[model samples]
Target: MTIVLTFMPFAVGIMDNDLRQLLAQVARGDRTAFAKLYDVVSGRLFGIIGRILPRAELAEDALQETFMRIWQRASSYDETIASPMAWMATIARNQAIDLKRRSAERLAALASELDETLADESPDPESLAGQAGDLRRLGECMQGLPNERQQLVLLAYRQGFTREELAERFKRPVTTIKTLLRRSLIALKECLDGAR
Candidate 1:
């Protein structure tokens, strides 16, 4: 059984040969080998996709697309240029980028359609001004945070990183990450309230 240590830092190790062999077998349409390969690498791939895609459903779709591409392109695996995991990770990252691009394009098209339909309607200037003021206040509050706290807050909220994921990335305990986030959020709230 392959022990998948997905949260470990990336390091080229002896498992590359085994992964290469698995890819070769998958290229030949070996279902068992493909299953084994998925079992070994899917956790790491999911984590990568999650970090990129933010939304869980989108990340799940990207992961499915990544595996589909892996099955189709397994024959192109070249161990000489990069490790097997590296190649697979590249495919997963590209898949996430493609998904993000497609989503952006779809949103842009929808926005264009909405703009055409609402061409006669004007946005309320008072509401817009209020929104701008709120945004400015929020930005100031965020800027007041220390750099590390700012990064942690942005990663947790904007990037959708879980506490466990932050802990792993920061090499800290999960409880510590939670406490830091709590303190940072409280500070931000206080700053925003004071600004108001």
Candidate 2:
């Protein structure tokens, strides 16, 4: 199989047995062996990740993750069951699928949250007035939030930034981003209720 990583391509010149030898060396904590394996396999892994994650940036990220996993889990490889390339490709595919699912979930959260608080489309004057008032209160509450938190919410909801992107931009962990969003929503709910 051919291996293409980002702009550069690496040929899979080594045979399957050679890959198994590299994996064994990697399992023994041979850094040089690991480096050799990476140079040989990264292009193929990137290709595998790209098939699952259409975005080039995400596929790049996934490729990095796949190597990290392979590096850590090389000792677990069973050549008797599957070839080394097959094993690594499986890791790349799973990592991309996980990234895709997580991004989708993060993107969906705020839209669903807003949908739950939104008024029905009955078009009644009184309901329209109440919806307008609630929307105004939301704007006010959002303004009351700290600038960073406000940016976080607006970026995630309005600009459609994913949790990973927010973490990178904010220089925080993904867990921290989730906690901040949850706390911000709680604060907004309290503010809205108190105003009512």
Output the TM-score of candidate 2.
0.54
- Over the stretch 35-85, how does candidate 2's per-residue lDDT look in tens digits? 999998898788888888877888999888888899899999998888888
lDDT over C-alpha atoms for residue 54 of model 2:
73
Q: Each candidate: what lDDT?
A: 0.85, 0.85
- Give one digit per residue, the lDDT tens place, for model 1 in 63-89: 999999999999988888888998999
TM for candidate 1 is 0.56
TM-score of each: 0.56, 0.54
lDDT of predicted model 1 = 0.85
Model 2: per-residue Cα lDDT at residue 50? 84
